[model samples]
Target: MEEGIAIRAENICKSFGEGDSYIEVIKNASFTIHKGELIALIAPSGGGKTTLLMMIGCVEEPSSGKIWLGDKQVFADKWLTRETRKIRREKIGFIFQAHYLIPFLNIIDNLTLLPQANKTDDKTARAKARELLKYFDIAEKEKAMPSQLSGGQNQRVAIARALVNEPQIILADEPTAALDMQRSVDVVKMLKQIALEQKVAIIMVTHDERMLPYCDRIMKIEDKTTIFEEQQLQKNSTHSD
Candidate 1:
């Protein structure tokens, strides 16, 4: 892995079942995500996009191969440590297609709960949550319940929640899937801004090609292999003409 790379996967393969009933979701896949880049994982349905993301997030272990997050080698054939959950909590953030906010809890509390549960002082967690809400332009809605917020506001709160821990890498699975076109663009733009401003690497899985323009790079999965194309390449080629 290169210096400052937030995630590196080496020849990862994930399989389920055995013999005639077996399925290989990801095959010999490898890639690296650098700090501060917003990348999109693009693939068709049942193409292992979520499987790959789950593996990288450490929520699901790979059946074979190696994985690294930042400077730590978190997986190699088997888990390198028993602290996978701790590593995930401290180093990774997650956003999903749904906001998944606690409906009963207000926005501020929703963001505060995880960090506090992780042993951050209550006051500190509250402070950090407030800061994140402000950063995401949802500070005024801190006291509002998730159901009270609009779709965009709710998603903003979710993003704030993800950032409250100051994680180095964020894994987003179709975060804008349920939103309208403009709202989807807004959410993805927010993610890109967060990646650059906070210097956090983000991998967002999406089937929407319209969102590709906002990504720093596009990664496509095919036959268990991953390929990348830098968005800058097109701009550079155009400028050189």
Candidate 2:
């Protein structure tokens, strides 16, 4: 991997089952995501978008080929380290379609939970969480529970929680799926700012083509392969299709 490249996947292939029962999802896919960029992952349903993201996030292992995150080669033929959980907690952040915040926990606690599990001191975790909340413009909601906040507020808190761990890569799966167009744009803009300001590479799995303008690059998984497109190229191609 080159300098400042947060993620690099080379000839990655994933499959399930064996023989006649087998199904191949991703094939010979190579891509790189650099720091300070927001990338949009666009694919039809069942196109392996979430599977690829989960593999990069260390939640799933590749069946073949190599994958790297920053300076570490996490997978070659198999996982480089036995402790994927540790790598995941330290190097990756995840956002889902649903906010997935614990209902009984207050916003602050929800944000602090993962960092604390990673052995960060309570003071440090809370301080980082507070800074992120302020950055996302939801500082006043820190004391509120998930049930008490609006959908957008909860999503903001989710973004804050993801950052509290200071992850190098963020994997967001359909983060704006539940929101209206305006709110979706709001979330994507916030993600763009976070990527540029924090220098963290963000891969957002989105079905909404309207949000592509906010991303620095677009990677579409098609025909069992990964096709990369510059934002300008995407404009000339995707919308016309």
Candidate 3:
């Protein structure tokens, strides 16, 4: 593991079935994501975009490959540890297309649940949750239910919740797909801000090319392999004219 490298994958492969029924999805994919970087993962439908993301997030195992989150090598042909769930809970944060905040829990409670479940004291967890709520500018909604907030507000809460654990890596899958253009842009900007401020690595799977400008780099899947490209961000040109 290299300094500041948050994720590293080498010769990773994934397939299903065997013999005549075998289907290969990804092959020989390799890449490294550094801390404080926001990367975009783009590919055609069913092109293993989410599959690769899931593998990195430890939700899906690679058929044969080596994966490292920070300095720990968690997989090589097989998962190195039986506690994949623990790894996810401790080292990774995940964001989905939908804001899956518990409907029964208020905004602050939704953020505190994971930390408390991970053994943090209730007072500490609530304090951290309050800090995140303030950071997201949703502090006034601490006691509001998910159903009471707008779509964008709930999504902000979702992003804040992902940060509550202070994980080294964040895996976001189409986080802004459900929002309108302006809202989507806002979400991407927020992600970029988080990566820089928290010094965390972020991999976002997106179908929208318009959001690429906000990312630090782009990772594309082609021919069952991975490609990396650097992004050219303008100085003070992130806004539309």
| Alpha carbon lDDT of each predicted model | 0.88, 0.89, 0.92
Can you write out model 1's per-residue Cα lDDT over 66-157, one digit (the tens) per residue?
99899999999999999888888899999989999999899888999889868999999999998888887888998999999988898888
Give the poorly placed runs of model 1, Cα more than 4 Å off: 233-241
**lDDT leaderboard ranking:** 3, 2, 1
- Candidate 2, poorest ten consecutive residues by summed lDDT: 232-241
Per residue, candidate 3 scores C-alpha lDDT tens digits across 1-241 of 5699999999999998999999999999999999988999999999999899999999899999899999999999999999999899888988989999999999999999889879999999999999999988999999999999999999999998898899999999999999999999889988888888898999999999999988989999999999998897741343432
Compared with the true structure, what per-residue lDDT tens digits does model 2 show for residues 47-162? 99988998898888889989999989999989989999999899999999989999999999999999889989999989989998898788998999999999999998998888
Itemize residue pairs with steric clashes in candidate 1: none
How far off is residue 233 in model 1, in Å?
A: 7.9
Q: Could you give the C-alpha RMSD of every candidate to the true structure, in order shown?
A: 3.3, 3.9, 1.7
- How well does each candidate superpose onto the true structure, as a TM-score? 0.94, 0.95, 0.96
Give the true-structure RMSD of model 1: 3.3
State the RMSD for candidate 3: 1.7
